[model samples]
Target: MTTVNADAATPTELNVLVRPLPDYPDAERAYSRSSSLLWRRSAGAVEILHPWTERTISDSVMVASLSELVELGVLSGQEQFEDAAVQMICSSAASEESAWRAYYLNSINELDNGTSPFSPVHRRARSLIAGHEVLEVGCCFGFFALACARDGHSVRACDISPGAIDLLTTASASLRIDVDACVGNALALPYPDDHVDTVTLIHLLEHLDVQDTTVAVTEALRVARHRVVIAVPFEEEPTEHFGHLLRLTEDDLRLWADRVDHAGAEIFTDHGGWLILTPHR
Candidate 1:
């Protein structure tokens, strides 16, 4: 019978009695093997022969096995922790949020057949321009302009990008949506004073610099006889990213609206990233 000395064995010596299965390979096999060999070489160090073979366990062996199992579990948890940390760092570096937003916007435009994501903006613009002429600033590809024209409103759309203007013109011809689409700057709008019944500025305010934004707003006011519908991203805080030239908080919009109202424009506030200012006719 093999002499089982439970009291003489340390935790490390008892751990040697249980070997991991051979089916799953480990990258640290060399280190593990070397450590096992060093422990086995010691004199009076509870010899664990054929540790891979199943055998009945003494109380000491059972206690040692339990301790070893706990240590292994801790080490495995640590490895998982490290892996999760690495993944988080990689995600932060990749700017995943911005990528997802861009992907969502592109997908919506492609899947929705060139409709604006904000339906409220579309509806409000249509209502404000019902049986009236409208001008759209920064009308890239003329989606909103075409929508208004299709609804029987005379539409004039302008964009800074020549390519966008050309695309808008081609689309107009194909859709048979009569629209005056041109390439023009918002700061120097190519329209006479009090010409249009409504001016629509969708997602345009945040792109303009301070001077340009003021000038563009003034130009829109000058061109519109009735109302100017403007929409921008809801500003929670000032952000350098997202092409935000100047973050317009609700307070900022109110202040500007007051100025426009003083200039004979009656500003109407609407929730959901939109503001409609009707000029006193």
Candidate 2:
């Protein structure tokens, strides 16, 4: 597991401004180490490298397996509902007790689609999370939660859907990762004020009902002692292909950050946007 180096300071806010990279910062070096078997490169032209088989779960396999479960009617009527259907399929996948290939599909799809963790925004957000006690809301497969645990942060992941939490719980055990998972709602998180040092959400706000955005933000802010962090698609295209109710910009995120007078805000734009709310000392 990777932890924050002691020389790394605690971050009150993260403000990384980015644009799409033709390739990630160290692709060549990363691939060299991989092709040499420290990691393995995917066969595709994009050259997404895969780590040793036991090191991490690959994304494509996870996405395909998850899609199959959906087609098999695992999430049938719940289609239009919140991510409950998606959650159920993830849980089923994890419960299958198969190798990494069968279990981590949803994680792959979300990362590939840039809806959740593994985005450039998340890469930057790691600085803020390195040494904090974090509570993650709407933590789908708990990928960030897993990342936090790997980095030795104390993390608790909660979701409105028990199915998502269930999957996360299974993944944690099977993968031997440490994360506390449970059920909680975005609109009405079940935690007291300052329950943790920081509260974070990744790629979850856009799916929220427009009216509930304020409610969700308020609840998360209320529970965080230091700050709240969020990542959302920047000026996303108009599409219902996914349940995104509203695409967000820094200005929109500012509205949510402003609810608390003592909270100061910073915005980082990358593949999408990242919002950091730091408390005034």
TM-score for every candidate vs. truth? 0.54, 0.63
- The per-residue C-alpha lDDT of model 2 at residue 234 equals 69
User: Which whole-number lDDT from 0 to 100 does residue 34 have in model 1?
Assistant: 27
Please give the lDDT score at residue 37 for candidate 2.
19
Q: Give the lDDT of residue 238 in candidate 1.
A: 38
TM-score of 1: 0.54
Model 1: how large is the Cα RMSD against the reference? 21.7
**Worst window of 10 by summed lDDT in candidate 2:** 11-20
Give candidate 2's whole-model lDDT: 0.59
Best by TM-score: 2
Clash pairs detected, candidate 1: none
